[model samples]
Target: MNFNGPLETSALRQVEICDSKLTDQLRLNAIERSRMMDSPNEEVFDRLAFLAAKFLQVPLTIVSIVGDKKQFFKAAHGLPSPYDVSREIPIEDSICRYTLQNEPIIADDATKHELLKHHPTIGPWGIGAFIAIPMLTHDGQVLGAFCAVDTKAKPWTEDDILMLKELTASVMREIHLREKISELEDESQLRDKFVAAISHDLRNPLNVAKMGAQLLSDMDGDEEERADISRVICENVDRADKMIQDLLTASRLKAGDKMPLEVTFGDLSALLHSTVESLQKGHRRAFHFESEKTIDGHWDFDRVRRVVENFSGNAVKYGDESKPIRISVEDHPESARISVHNYGPSIPSDEIDNLFNLFKRAQSARDSKHLGWGVGLTVARSLAEEMGGRIEVESTEEKGTIFSLHLPKVKPSLH
Candidate 1:
C-alpha cells in the first residue's frame, strides 16, 4: 500500500526551495493556464510533449501542470478527453506534486499502494504504473510535469529517469525561449513606436556629455584629470561597442553563420604559447606551458587559439588568482592533445552534462565574481568538432579542473 516510499523520497530530493509567496502563486497560476490548453494544436509545445511521450514508449503520457487547485493535463496521449475526470486531486495524493518537490523522475508501481489501487484512473482504467519528471524553466522554475503511465508494473532504470528528465528540460527550455521572444517582440514594437521620441530626448544630453569630456581633455587643467576624463569617454564608447558586437554575434550564431574553419598543418605549441603570453599581459596570472613532444597537427589555428584563450581566461578569472594556469601539449603518431589546467573549485557532478550547453553555467560561476555570457565553452566545443577534434573537461573538488582538447593528426597526401 506504500507506493510512496521510494517514489516520494526520490521526488522530494529534487524540490527547489522557494520562500516567496508571490512567486509560488504566479507559478501555480501559470500551471493552471497551461493545463486548460487543449491538445493537437498548432503550438510547437503540444507536438513536443506528444513526441516525448511517444519516444519514451509510454502508454499514457500527460503534460501535467500542477496548480493550487488541481493537476491539469495540458496535453494527453491515450486518453479520450483533454481534461482529466478529476479537476483537482488533493495535493497530498497528486504524484506530480511530488515531482514539483523533487528533481528526479518519480516512478512508482501503483499496484502496491492501497490508495492508488482503488483510485478512479488506476482502478477502473487499469493504469497502475506511473513515471513523472519535473519540467523546469531555465531560471530553475518548476513549470509543470511530464509523465507516462501504464497498467502493468515496470521496473525503471536510472537511465530512463535521466533521459526523461533531459527531454522534459529540453521542452521547458524551448517554451521559455518562445515566451522570451514573445516578450521581446512586444518590447520591440513599443520601442519602434517611441523611437523618434526617445532618440530626440536622449541625443542632446549624450552629445553634451561627449563634447564636455572632449573640452576637458583639450583644456589640460591637470594631467591626471585629463587622463581620467579621456578614460571615462573611452570606457563608455568601448562598452557601447561591446554591446553592439554581442548582439551581432548572437544573431550570427543563431543563424549558423559562425566563422568557417580552414585546417592546416601548424605548430600548436607556438600558438598556445602566444595565447598564454597575450593573456598574461592582460590578467596578472602566472601562465606556464609544457610540451612532452613537438606537435605539428592539422587544425584551424585561429579556432584552436580561441579555445585556448577562452580556457585560459576562464582559469584566470575563476581559479585562484595566485595559482598558476598550466598548459600542456602532447602528440602521438595518430593524435594530438592539449590540456589547460587550473587550481579552482571543482564543478558539481550534476552540472557536468550541461557545461557545454549554450547559455549554461555552473552554480559556482553564478556565485563567483567571474562574469560571462556562458557561451564560451559551447563555442569552443563547436569549433573543435569542426576541426575534427573533441574537447572534454575533468574536475574534482579536491584536485581542481582540467580541460582537454584532442585532435586527429593529419598526414600529408603523397603527390
Candidate 2:
C-alpha cells in the first residue's frame, strides 16, 4: 500500500503542538534502537498488552512503534483482520502516531474528539474510546505508544490511566534492556574479530621466522645466503614485536593516556628519506621521496618515523604495488606537512572517519591480501596527535589516496 507524505496533526487546545522532520527522524532512530520492529510477539510484551486491555476493560491493546513508512504492532491483544496477521499497517493509518509528541492522548470518543475525529483509525476502522501513553526515551524521543482501545465509547477513569502508565513503563524497561543486550552482542562480536585478526596477523610473522630458521640450518656454507637468511629471520621477529608494541600503544591511547614522547628538533624531510630507504630495503616496492627543502620541527623523531612508516606500510598493503609510492614533505609558515600517496582504489567516503579507529578497517584494507589487526593506523593517529600534529587523508578515484601528517613548527606543551 502506498504511504503518503506527512500528515498534519490537529492542534490540541491544551497541548502545545510541535512536530518536524528532525523530531520524526530522531523518533525513528529511537525506535530502531528499541529493536522491536518486525520482531515476533514476545510473551513478556504480549502479557503487558493483555494486562493493559484487561485492566482498562478494553478489547484492544497494542505496543506499537511507528516507523517512517509503517506502524509495527510489536505486541497486540485484540487487533482484528489483516493487521493482526500482518502485524503492521501503513503509517497513514496509525492512530499511535498522534501520541508521538510525548503527549498522553485520551479520547473518550474518537468520533466526537476534535483531534482524532477525521483520523482513519476512527473514521473507517471504527475505533471508539482510546487512550495512548507515549513510550518516551531518556533523551526525549518518542518511540510510539502503549495504547488501549474499546469498540464502545467509554470514559477512562484515573485508575485506568495509572495502570496504563505503569504498564507503559514496563514496556520501556524491556526496550531499554533489549538495547543494552544488542550493544553487548555487538561488543562481543567485535572482540571475536579482534582475536581472529590478531591471531592471523601474528601467525604470519611466526611462520616466516620459523621457515627462515629452517633454511639457515639446511644451508651448508654459503656465507652470503646465511646472512640473508639471518636478516629475514630478524626482520620477521622485529615485525611481530612491532605489532605487539602497536597493540599496547593503542590500548594506552584508548584509555585516554597521552602517548609518551621525547621531543627533539628534527628535519621531517631527512626523516622521510631515511624511512623510505629503510622500507625499500625491506620490501620490493619502490618508494620515492620528494622535498624542495628541509622542514624542521620540534617533534619526537621516533614517533614521527613510526607514524610515517605505518602510513607507508598501509600504502604498500592497499595500494597498487606496480606503481611507486610517493612521499612528499611540505613546509608551511605555521605547520609542516608530510604525505604518503599511493595509486590505488579510493577508500569509500563512509569508511574514512573510522579508518584510524582501533580494531576498525576500511573495506579496501579488509579485502586486500594483507592481514592486519587494524591497530597500526590507530597508533599512528595517537602518536601524531601526541606530537602536536594531526593526520589528514584525501582519497578519490581521480587522485588516488593520500595520508598526510600535518605538524606545527613549534612543540606543543604536554601538560
Candidate 3:
C-alpha cells in the first residue's frame, strides 16, 4: 500500500533531464491540495471536476491525490461518493502516478498494458481506455490529477489529450480564483455585520436625542438657541436616516425582493425636470437639463425616478459641486435614453464589469467622503433589467463619466 517516490534513475540521466520534467514536487503539491479540499465550501472544486468531465466527454472525472496508503478523491464528478477505494493499489497499478512520472498526461490501452490487464475495477466497471493529466499549481506543484474514464476501448486522438490538458489547466486556475473570492466575501460579510451592530446600538440614543431636542425647543428660551438646537438634532436625524436607508437598499437588492414595478407611459422630460428641481434644493451644485427630440417611454415611473435621483446624488457627491451636472434625454423611435454625465476621475477598466455586483464600488469611489453603501447602481441595474431595459456606464479621463439608462418606447396597440 506504500506508494514510494519515483524510482531512482542514474545520476547522469537525472542530471541531463530538464527540471520541468521532475514529478516529485508535483506529486507532493497534489497531496497538499487534496488536504485543502477537505475543508468546507469545496463546491468550487467539484464544479471544476464536473466541467473537466463534460469537456472530455467522459463518464468519469476525478481530482485525486495519491497518498502512501490511499488515493483520495478531492472532487469527483461522475462518482457518487468522495472516497471510492478503501486503500491505494500498488504504485505500478496507479495510472495517474505513472502518467505524472511520464510527461503530464498518460493514456494506455487497457488490453495492452500488462500492469492493468488484470485490474478488477477496470474489467468489472467495463472501463477500457483512460487518461490522466497532472494538475499543477502556478508554483509548479502538482495539486492532483485530472482524469477521465470511458467504458469503451476506443482509441483517443492526440487532440483529445491536448483538450483534456487545457481543461485541467483551466480547472486549476478556477480553483485559485474561487479561493480568493471566498476570502473577499468573508471579509465583506464581517464588515457588514460590524456596521449593522453599531447602527442598531445607535438607534435608541438617536431617538432619545430627537425627543429631547423637541422638548427643549418648545420651552421658552432665546429664539436663536432653540433654532440652533433644533437644527443640530435635525441634521443628526437626517444622517442616521440616510445610513439606514442605504443599508436597507443594499439588503433588499441582495435579497431580490424589492417592490414590484408598475410600468406606465411617462414623459422623460417632465420626470427629469421635477427630479432635478427636487435634488437641487439645499444642494450647492448647478444642474443643467437638456433633451433632444421629445423623449417618452413606458417604464416604472417611481423606479426610474429613483435611478435618476441616485445618479444625480452620485454626481453631486463625487463631481465638482462648483460645476454643473448635466442630464440629457435622447429619444429614438424604438427606445429612449437618459444619460447623467458628471465631471470626475475616470473609472478603472477592470472594475467596470463588476460595478453592478452587490456592494461593489470602483476604487476611485472608495475614498470619496459622500459615499453610500455602494448599492445604488446595483439596485438601479436590477430594476432596469426587470423593466426590460438596460443600463451602461462610459468614462474617460478628459470627458468625465456618463451613466446611461435605456428603455423601450411604448407603441400604440394595433387592435
lDDT of 1 by residue, 11-75 (tens): 23333242231138656555443333233333555665677666667767767666554556666
Q: Rate the local accuracy (lDDT) of all candidates.
A: 0.65, 0.83, 0.66
Task: Please identify which of the two predictions, 1 or 3, would achieve the higher TM-score against the true structure.
Answer: 3
| lDDT of residue 354 for candidate 1 | 73
Residue range 35-148, candidate 2, lDDT tens digits: 788988899999999998888988999999877778899998998998899999877677777676678989898777766665655746668898999888888988888989
The predictions' CA RMSDs to the true structure, in order, are: 12.0, 5.1, 12.5
Model 3 Cα shift for residue 142 (angstroms) = 16
List, in order, the clash count of every candidate structure. 5, 0, 3
State the lDDT at 315 in candidate 3: 82
After superposition, the stretches of candidate 3 with alpha carbons farther than 4 Å from their true spots are 1-216, 219-246, 411-415
Clashing pairs in 2: none
Worst 10 residues of 1 by lDDT: 13-22
Candidate structures ordered by lDDT, highest first = 2, 3, 1
Q: What lDDT does candidate 1 reach at residue 74?
A: 62
Candidate 3: worst-modelled 10 consecutive residues by lDDT = 11-20
By the TM-score metric, which is better: model 1 or model 2? 2
C-alpha root-mean-square deviation, candidate 1:
12.0
Error of 2 at 208 (Å): 3.1
